[model samples]
Target: MKNVSRVFYITLALVIITVIFGAAFPAQFEGITGSIKSYVATTFGWYYLLLMSALVIVAVSISISPWGKIRLGKDGEKPEFSLPTWTAMLFSAGMGIGLVFYGAAEPLFHYLSDSPTAETGSGKAFKEGLVYAYYHWGIHVWAMYGVTALALAFFQFRKGEPGLISTTLKPLFGDKMNGPLGTLIDVLAVFATVFGVATSLGFGAVQINGGLSHLFDVEVGFTSQFFIITVVTLLFLVSAWTGLSKGIKYLSNTNLVLSVVLLVLVLIIGPTILILNMFTETFGMYIQNFIEISFRTAPLESDNRSWLDSWTIFYWAWWVSWAPFVGMFIARVSRGRTIRQFLTGVLTIPTLLVSIWFAVFGTTSGNIQNNGTELTQYATELVLFNMFDQLPLSLILSLLAIVLIGSFFITSADSATFVLGMQSTNGSLLPANRIKIVWGLAQSSVALILLYVGGLQAIQNTIIAAALPFSFVMILMVIALFKALNEEHKKMEAEEEKKQNS
Candidate 1:
């Protein structure tokens, strides 16, 4: 308790101080953050690609190997939540707001943007657009989450260790995880989780404000965004007070249903056949070109290299930043499941849903673009609402979309609070309510500060910068987890031998 409290307060003080500095000196902060982000991306672009690829390989290998049978908890334990509910929570916490925000915008951007290998506004460009969208949102990002979640679940559940990111590396470090090094690691995890989720919260607030403006004639600016953030933060804190099983679970379930309804409405009222065909063709292209797309840095082509850094590198960094929060939440909800089942669920389900979502929304937007409607002319944040305008019952669907985004905002914020509390409280499965509330407010404050500092782009640059060091942390975690798993396997084998001898 003493150690957890000390770490929690230290982390809280550091985060508050940083946010204050950023808010007070917005230009200086953005300059520093932006420089660091560019340096990391330009220098280590290949490293990010290689590391992400290795993570995917490791996750897949572990799932298919004999280790697949190893339960995250005890051998006889079953899953905590049913498949459907569990999947809902995973999607909600993982990338619910992102999918909604970018489903229409990303594909359209890719379609219109210049590409080195594909000509803009051509058939190849359209295919490449959806393909890249899948590449960004697909197995790689989930694998990053899966590896971290698997390590945490194994150490915390199976081995009876604390849920801190440092604790997962206890196999290699032994007691050092209890020392200053461990404190540093845990502090970094908290920082990463808070900023990562704050970035999402900032996005949610902007999009929600945009939705309101589109639907209700409300104004759109910092005032509207701040108001949305304030109100939604209170809602999430109250939801956090209700605890995970009731508050988060119910919201996640509702989010999934509403999301599905929106997707269905878009499909039915939009070009239904075109979306279906786009899904089939896009899925095929994504699978076929997955490897090339994953490793393409446009090394020889400077212009294409710039585009790669802006889009693909940024996405990888964003996902890595998010791994701690999403990974811990997934680990919390994924107790008593086998490695195979966990990987399958995390990697497959959400990727498929994202693909379908991008197909429907992306293709519909593309159709509008082709018809001279020029969907991309609107701001990226407003593109989703604009696409909604083209369909039947635009008003109702737009309102529902706002409700869905707000629900996702609350769920994501509350989940981060829970994860942050757990990380700060020595990985207690049920962290104290006071801690949850404190972190909840802190997360909202960071978002509010970032909004004032430089809005969405500033939030993104901060996330990419923060994610740099943690990417190395994730790599070390993979090594430690593999070592621990191997030791566990040997111990199990020795126990079996002893029983036979007896």
Candidate 2:
């Protein structure tokens, strides 16, 4: 296992280094990796959405099943957190900065552009947009995180296997993956997650830079980007080294508090009537057309193809790239959680919170865009900052917004750092401090390089591309999960029969 991990890392280092130097000269790397991303998206993007949907269905089923009832602890072991606290922590950590990014923008984007339902309509598209955003961002995505996390948590804490995907798959693969195959899964998951998360870091850095630049009227280019990365990295590294109890626990608590406050602030400032109305309409549309939207596969020639690809395909890949890290982190925290508890926490709670946030924030942001707001006149880069700047409480609210974004990014970065350490050190929850520091620094460096290269969009696309292969691995996970469910059921039945006979 060690040899395999070593070889994989060596190869990965070479590839990343090559990409870096290749990207150093702008013209060369763009034509290479950029073309690859476009080609893959053009070809298999629809299939990716289908796979994402399938994974969601599979995860939901597993979450409600009897096998899922099995706790991670040993026979006499007790749970860590009470139900509500555990649920909140799991949802917050699983979600992280994603809420901050998509919360306002995504729904508005969907509302402006057509979704699978109203591809050609421009009327009432804003409500359509919020619903569509909720659709994509809702339970399905987190269900993916929940299932992957459950697999790792159960295998490691319950079955005494290493807390990696390979161990999660051992029930199906048996010992075959215990050698090279298992190592391969871990390596792929690690690589995909690193690049994927680094992309989020890049986005967070850019957004942070934008927020600061808007407040101070400075340029939000390379220097500011690097500055944000350095500051955030130090913060996360400190949190990570402090371990889950002190650093992670405290940060998450802060994150939850600040997020709620931000939401409340938006609700107070925004037009409550418009925001609530849009929320209701969008939600209704989502329910009315839930199946169609979820299963929509308008072909290349179909009118809805472009819209679906932009919204759904992109999100599916984005989530896939993120699954490993989020999954591992969720599993780590869900040590003693029941399957139903895990599912509801991952699916329902975050979705409800995100929906409300979008209703308030996204609606207000979109309202500014719809009206002759000064913010919309600017480029997309400046738009978000300008929108917040124009708010009634611009100065105070903008500062709060900055804090919200920074804290969200910190929560995600710290969690990933912890999980990466665990993955690196053979699935030990309490990995060595040195290992934690190494991963933290590496994550920070990767974020910096990615920011320097093609900015946030390029980083996101590149990371999404890496996840193309692991999408298959996740499919295998879904299958393995069901098989484990069946096996556990059979074991229960046999035990029951033995008891009756005796």
The estimated TM-scores of all candidates read 0.98, 0.92
Q: How many angstroms is residue 312 displaced in model 1 relative to the true structure, after the best TM-score fit?
A: 1.0
Write model 1 residue lDDT over 380-441, tens digit each, in one string: 88998898887789898888888889999999999999999898888887888888989998
Q: 110-168 in candidate 2: lDDT tens per residue? A: 55545455543255676677777787777678777777877777778767887777777
lDDT of 2: 0.72
Q: Highest TM-score: which candidate?
A: 1
RMSD values for the candidates in order, in angstroms, are 1.4, 2.6
Q: What ranges in model 1 sit over 4 Å off?
A: 1-3, 498-502
Clashing pairs for model 1 are: none
Candidate 1 has a TM-score of: 0.98
